[model samples]
Target: MSKQAVALTLTDLNADTPCCPPIAQRRIPAESAAVLAPAFKALGDPVRLQLMSMIASAPDGEICVCDLTPAFELSGPTISHHLKTLRDAGLVDSDRRGTWVYYRARPTIMRQLAALLTVEAT
Candidate 1:
């Protein structure tokens, strides 16, 4: 990863290129790696990754906790813990409505994560 690899731009994700020149092309910057590592960490778990995908791909842009809990075989508290992990990572947002809690995806961070992982034409 070189300095250039660390300096991500919107066009990197938009144009005909991968995100960066590739870790092989240069050295990865500590700052860029630090900012992106958490996102990868958050997704390292199968449960959390599934939860993130579920929330991100939700039909109405959000899903209820009740809905999420029943979809998994894990206990309620365990699911809650995973959801909390995502929330703390700035990946999801939750809110209560009546008796149910609903969660929505945070697209900004998702986009940022996608951009950081991109490779370039070079």
Candidate 2:
């Protein structure tokens, strides 16, 4: 029997093109929902949510894992797992420099999420 290799690719959250119209404006298509649901699920965890805020608000547009670990009581590995979840969700990107790994928010995805949630005053 031959085994088939499945390749998985993440949606480019940083693309210039918008993923879809705002959720308030129209119903989201299944493909867009499939791509975005994981990102929302990743943020459903409080720790991951805070981590996302920190990475997004970092002055230099990125922050180191070493710096992020000290802010939480969780162990380094636990924090890393959460970061990995964010990475897989296409909400953030990471770079390793020596012993430290830095994370940067993908602003395009953030903007898309914000737009979807925005409710104009009637």
Candidate 3:
């Protein structure tokens, strides 16, 4: 299946539980780790982490780039760069509407990250 198809399929799964066994129970393949590493790296910055949270938790399910920029001390272009990084990492999707871009979280990746981090009680 295509990567987009796989992402959609994974998002349809139960959210209360993980789709894969936790990291403690199974090792992550090098390929999978490589794929996920960018997402982790994108979130390593406090600005990017806050940006992701803002995008993910937006009441309308998406937020305009205009709205996102004012929340930070950085310049608009800097914020755009961070958003581009998030886009490159596949953690968020963006749509440009006329002059502004809107961003929304990609649930599939969020779920994948959550699944990997979940620690089941012993």
Alpha-carbon TM-score of each model against the true structure: 0.75, 0.86, 0.82
Best by the lDDT measure: 2
Between prediction 1 and prediction 3, which has the larger lDDT?
3
For model 2, the stretches where C-alpha displacement exceeds 4 angstroms are 1-12
For candidate 3, give the lDDT: 0.80
Error of 3 at 44 (Å): 0.8
Candidate 3 residue spans exceeding 4 A from truth: 1-20
TM-score computed on alpha carbons, candidate 1? 0.75
**Model 1 weakest 10-residue run by lDDT:** 6-15
Per-residue CA lDDT of model 3 for 37-71, tens digit only, reads 77789999999999999999999999999999999
Backbone clashes, each candidate: 10, 0, 0
* Candidate 2 C-alpha lDDT tens digits along 1-122: 12121111234455566666778888976666766788799999999999999999999999999999999999999999999999988899999999878999988888877777877789
Comparing 1 and 2 on lDDT, the stronger one = 2
Better of 2 and 3 by lDDT: 2
Give the number of the best model, judged by TM-score. Answer: 2
TM-score ranking from best to worst?
2, 3, 1
